[model samples]
Target: MNKKDHSLLTRSFKNISVLFFIVVLLLLFVVILINVLFGIYTWDRLYMDLINALVGVMIPLVLFNFLYDRFTQQHKDRELSEKITETMLLDEQVIDRFSNDSKKAFIQKSTESILGKTVGNMVYDTLIQSYLSKSYQYRHHFKYYISYLGDKVTKTFAVDDETIFIFNPDDYYFVREDLSFERDITNFIQSNDVRIGFSYKESTLDGLYQRAEFMFRENLWVNEEHNSMLQELSNHEMEQFVKSFLQFTIEIDGEVVPYQVIHNEGYEGFHLLLDIPETLHSSVLSKVHIRFQMPQLRTQKKFIVMISEPTEDVEIMFMHLENEMEVEAIPFLNEAESITRLPNDTIKIDIHDWILPRAGVVFVWNDRQ
Candidate 1:
């Protein structure tokens, strides 16, 4: 249910509960009042009067204990509910805090913080639906988190830095391919409440804040641009693209030299980047290899590279991934070409190579997944 409905139900529950208890309290008071007047006019003995006085005191004390216990739990439940509502409100406000650039980044970070470094359309969709299904997993934790209601509630909350986001952890069936930041966030918060209890943990707030702050200090979604496309580029284009993207520059003989990346005509697909000594600026002593296309968000496109000194004996030894994805070491040149995974899943390929250069080296791997 939505926040309004959830809150309204909570209020209704509280109001009815309180009204019922108040009526009981009033009945006891009326009885005492009636007895006092009757004893004042009808009683003839002090002993009888003393007994009535003791009875009046005992009745109020009983009602007081009953009301205190009931309201104590009621107050606790209300506090937890308020926190949950606050979390939802904060999430709604975040819709404006982010920009198009950081949207995917923030979502990936938020997802990774919970599900770890795993990527696939299936994994993302499953996690989202699992929270929305009737099998509300977090219900008990939220229900008993702040009160003694125990684990009767099946709803959950991802409490944040002064914000609370409701969640569900259960075996549910919901398969949606269009998994995105807004959709997932909305589904996570709009889930129906189940049972009645609470579970409080400081980490809950930490998780929510991590994502909320994604574009807070710096608007990540606004300015950060992601370039992930599969295409072939001529050597000249590759050089300019990679250099600009990496801001790559080198110092030669105490002076900074900007190197141009070139695709190998003989290899047909290898783009090379090396700081050419002014002497061998024409020689082929380049040091880097261009592999598969660049990656983005949670997509681990086949990003690979072979790096070694032209003077050293080596086969593909390194790769990088600045994103989330699973990559395998595929030997390109020879069976003896030992392969190793890249760092951070980021193979910074200058995919913008399509702008300049013509057929010098033919890029391999044209099939799309």
Candidate 2:
């Protein structure tokens, strides 16, 4: 039984014993008064007889109550042990029979045979506390199972991510971001500063080659000056200019890997095919470095880094290379580990620990003076 039940039982026994003793005292007092009124014995002799009677009644009552309580406790303990044993047997699908009571008697007995009983009980209690907790419900079993499998299949942890923003001498900003992470069947998507985009669903035939597509919207100039600078360029020249501003490279285990980029039919963006080695599918680490430039016409800008998978450490730095600017960094769904401002006009934000998906940092900046 639990502690609350045991305590209630003990309290009830104590109350009953007290009530019985009180009734016995009242009966003995009445008998003594009747004898005195009838003049059968002197007051002192009556008092002595009353004392003897009281002693005889009280001793047997106390002894019988003690024995009864001991037997009752023993019975309850046996019942509790039997219940636990039956539960364990049912959990293991053991045949319910007297002869098989000792067969597969849970982890407690199995562990006790190897370790001592004390250590075995400790292990058993720990497991019971964890798996058989009161908070656990049978209805949530599927939910818990799905969560376990999701963590296993989609497990990707980032080792390090560093993004640096440098203010250029011209009316453009330079950004270089480097990221290292463990990959599984992960899809990496990259896009420019476009309002709308689309991606092709990954497809594989006969488990050999995979095909996918990435789309980007046509460039939307923020100001007339920005539009005039690239208005005279042909389609090919515009594509080259855009490509020059946005460059992407990837490496696996410190070796450069080749990838194909093909222009999609009737689309503004291109299709990419990555020839990832089968041997380094999920076991090896990969790094991606991207360099891009943003025009100054977009005065108020927000640079957001969204975490799509588990990550360990992330750092973002903003360096004032040319002009002064006002910058503020904010973390979503979590607090940053540290934000430091260096002596060389650099603001760095660091986050350490396992950051879940959809939790990320946002850097907002605007021109000053």
Candidate 3:
């Protein structure tokens, strides 16, 4: 072989080796960067780092993806808010009965998966509810469906032994928020004893994995137990029923959310402290809804609900003994100090002047139910 041909071959080999080495270095850098971004979560200064990174050049790719998604989601959410109703529809096949062990297992498994295996039981199970909540949100970057359709539109089903799917319209509001609203979810979880699990519908988009899981959560559902008594009026057998406390059945959102509200004393008239589901727009502290048979009182005709702390908006509603019975609540003054008379027809307490916590009179009118 000629000297020139040998020299050309040697140079080609060196160039090829250098190019391979460069490619390997670039690939290794990419892998390390991804691991650093995803795997390295610290207890300290992590949030500030994210906030600073959200700007132009330094923004993390995962953060950018989530931010872009949530930004575009605002439009969809606006449409959703108008279409969706505020209340939840309870499904007939909803699974309410769970063995104690089953309940514990659900809670344990749920917390562990979202909060990571190393998180302490006390942290996820008990205190720092908000922390666990953020962890739950961080578990994925996707969305799901909720049951409630809209206001003035409610439909119940009667299924045989099938799973009853109780869902809130607000569930979609929180769940689809992506990573932008992780702070809010975190705060909510910390305050609320929220243990959440999922139900799969077995469908997906990107791959074979299930996608559209119908979301549900736990809530305190009201039930009516008749406490009938004797009423003697001019040889009349008219029934006079004195109302008892509103019986609250702890429905854990079709066994998806395992939070059991432990009754602990709060302020003057606040007995509940743990939580309502994350789906609802209002906080647990603000909501004041009382349902009774509308006591057939012989003496008192009117009742006044007062607000001690003075809430900006409060709902005062009433439901009749008859299932078909519906009521329309009269709007009260806008000021928080102003009081409103309780009407028999009111069904929802979406807005209120204020529920005077000091007086804390939760009962309705004495004469007219």
Candidate 4:
């Protein structure tokens, strides 16, 4: 029966029980009055008979109520099980799409809607355990992690079998970016403007800030047109020339932020170590701005931005001096959501979905020959 029908039946049964008890009491009072006035039976005999009748009636009534309640509960459980099975059959793909943790949560919510909080939790435990057992199969020793009611439990399942590990989605970090590059071909210079926003997930430090790192790398390649002059410079002179043309500024939320730079021994890049202020710790999103100007030689036909972190949204725009150069931008490894060319020799590419590291955009340009 449905919940409403079950409730109505229970109420009706309770009312019948109360009415029967009242009727018994009235009958006993009438018997007592008859014995006192008309002497229908002796007081001792009447009391004994009354006690036997009461016991007989009460015993059967209590037994019937107990059996009925048990049957109703069994019916409800069976019905719920059938519904769960049907849902699984219809939404197999949907369920498979959810991560392990999300699957557990979905099961809890779906079951809780049909049962009381306490019973729902009990049902959730049984269902989730069954799901994990069937979904995860191992022949030998396997270490499995399961999240039950917000608690994580790790246990070895099946010794002498292949091991399988499940990764937690929460452990993944994601960031968003808005990057722009402006080229001034007249001076062989390019200005880069980047804005990054992210949130902290894991950290191990004390104080009002969390330590983070950012790396920047720029390489200069000489072509036939400029090889003679560049090749004449010594290694030390070349490094100095590259450093002299690079000017950058870092800011957090509009205010300038300080960082310690660590230059690579043999590379054309450096690393910046800074602390994220406590104000943007776990609650608020943090925004970092990096702007830099570097030499853009004629031989450098392409500028690539590599995604080294999990990114959700990225907007890249490239603007060059009109009538000076032509550029084309393309996404590597993944397709962009939108690519638009605006006025003033500008091109913009946007990626609006989650993209993993190593996938990024490449901008290729050439002089207007």
Top-scoring candidate (TM-score) = 4
lDDT of 2 by residue, 8-60 (tens): 99999999999999999999889878878999767998779769999999999
Error of 4 at 158 (Å): 68
Please, what is the whole-model Cα lDDT of each candidate in the order they appear?
0.33, 0.47, 0.33, 0.48
Model 3 per-residue lDDT at 296:
21
- Cα deviation of 149 in candidate 3 (Å)? 26
Per-residue C-alpha lDDT of model 3 across residues 191-308, encoded as one tens digit per residue? 5533221111111111211111201122212111111111111111111111111122223222222223222122111122234455643332222222121122112222233332
lDDT (tens digit, per residue) of candidate 4 on 187-295 = 1111122212211111111111211122223333323333344444444444443333334455545657554443334332234444444443332333445554333
| Superior by lDDT: candidate 3 or candidate 4 | 4
Count clashing pairs, candidate 3.
Answer: 26
Off by over 4 Å in 4: 1-245, 275-283, 333-336
What's the lDDT for residue 329 in model 2?
Answer: 63
How badly does each model clash, as a count of residue pairs? Answer: 36, 0, 26, 6
State the lDDT at 21 in candidate 2: 100
Residue 125 of model 2 has an lDDT of 70
Better of 2 and 3 by lDDT: 2
Residue-wise C-alpha lDDT for candidate 1, range 1-369, written one tens digit per residue: 999999999999999999999999999778767876877534355558769899989999999999999999999999997785466447867655767445545455556656676664345555444433422121000000000011222332122232121212221111111100101112222332101100022222223222321110100010012111111444545454445432333333334434444444422222223333344233222222111111121121222221110112321222322232233434334233333333543221221111111111111222223
TM-score of each model, in listed order: 0.20, 0.40, 0.20, 0.41
- Please report how far candidate 4 places residue 80 from its true position, in Å: 6.5
Off by over 4 Å in 3: 1-188, 192-315, 319-369
**Deviation (Å) of 236 in candidate 4:** 13
Rank by lDDT, highest first.
4, 2, 1, 3
**Model 4 — which ten-residue stretch has the worst lDDT?**
139-148
